[model samples]
Target: MNILDDLKLQYKLGGIALKMIYWNVACFLVSLVFFYSFKVGVFDFPSWIALSSEPAVFVLKPWTFLSYAFFHDGFLHLFFNMMVLNFSSYLFLTFFSSKQYLGLYILSAIFAGVIFVLGFNLMHYSGAIIGASAAIMAILVAVTTYSPLMNVRLLLVGNVKLWHVTAVILILDLMQFRLENSGGHISHLAGAFFGFVYIKLLQNGIDMSKILSIVLDFFTNIFKKPATPFKKVHKNYQKPAERPVSKIVVKDKKQQQIDEILDKISQSGYDSLSQEEKEFLFQAGK
Candidate 1:
């Protein structure tokens, strides 16, 4: 298959993690087209699309809580986030179901977004945030929480514990907590925090992911198509001696010729037919 067809095939066959990556890539492409400003060298995401710190904006456009996680501001932002996402998804899916993975990704994003907005408002800061950093961190942290001692190998860093990788990321975010992009840092930490809470709750027999499933089922049922009723007909069985005799049918000269031509076509393909046979078959078809 060609490149595009191959990608389509992969998407169709891959699990939730690959589908999530595809979604992020698709959203990034969309943002590049409609939100990015070449002259300004930045994306100009609207309040409805990006999560705004302002209570008024987010409160009015509540969907931004989840929508913002799908968009990225630049190519590098999308690239690194996707790389981490692929890594985290691989590790997370190792010990969890696809449903749980999807639930954690979505729920953590909303949880982080809410905390980001609250933290920003408390600090009297006003800004917009876009990107899957928060959600990606949650996935990474969630799996790390579940399996802290799991071994992970890095190219330049050699082998290390999963928790070590998670800790380093959390530390980096904490170190830059007040340096730059404070909102981004806050959201990342918040996501990590949510991830820990999610695992804890799950361990305690409280699967918060069920909440998402319940809500989704509710909406799905609301829009679900009703099944059409089909009538069933029961056939009566009969003994061989008691069954009606089958009728014999005779084919006309033209039909006999057509059947011979069809059998020949089936055995040797349509191309094997002679010129007269082809013409006769064509005329018969008409």
Candidate 2:
């Protein structure tokens, strides 16, 4: 099929992380087109746009802090970020739910933006940061934290524990603190820290997904009518005669058999059952 169709297929089949990477790439492309067509400066792109004209070192725009992670200034920048995002996200989705993935992505972006801003302010760095490297770093950290002993194979390198990769990336970022793109490095570290914290919190059963759920429920309740009070409507309703002992016992026995069958289906594969059993399980699941 055509390229767009191929991409659509990939996105449909890929997990949440891949879909996120695709969104970032699409945003970068759109920003590039705007930059060229509208004569907007390349540095004015979403990722690294100047925060303030008067303050050269500040990068505090509300949207820039988060949106910057989705924009790239060059082909190489986009390529490496996408590669890391794809690989790390694959590992991440294999373990976490979609809500967890989305939460991590958003929090990672925010943490990265904050770190970038803080670093620029503290170190007097003047350049704006862009790209998803920080967010990808966060994903890498989360994957490694969740599955520390998991072995990952690089193209040229042999299989290595996931934590080793995490360690190396953190060290590299630490050593590169004085580089011109120090703000970006700091942001990556921030994202990595957030990922680590997120996993730790998750291990303790603290889910941030509830926050979004509550907000959605509030909005839904706002637009919906209140529940009506229950009314006791009484008519000359006569109680039915008691079921026969044998019939009642047989029906109860049948229900017990159905429950047992359903339990078995849940523990084993549906293919383990016959057609009649399959129908029974389907009806029960519904």
Top-lDDT structure, candidate number: 1
Please give the range of 10 consecutive residues that has the lowest summed lDDT in model 1: 242-251
Stretches of model 1 off by over 4 angstroms after superposition: 230-232, 238-286
Cα RMSD of predicted structure 1 = 12.0
The number of residue pairs in model 2 that clash at the backbone is 1
Tens-digit per-residue lDDT, 1-286, candidate 1? 2456446644654689989999999999998899888998888998899999988788899999999999998899999999999999999999999989989999999999999999998999998888999999999998998999999999999999999999999999999999999999999999999999999998999988888999999999999999989989897986657544333223366788888987886588655767677667555654
Q: How far in Å is the alpha carbon of 99 misplaced in model 1?
A: 0.5
Tens digit of lDDT per residue, candidate 2, span 95-144? 88888777777778877777676667676655567778877888899989
* lDDT of the structure predicted as candidate 1: 0.88
True lDDT of residue 93, candidate 1: 93
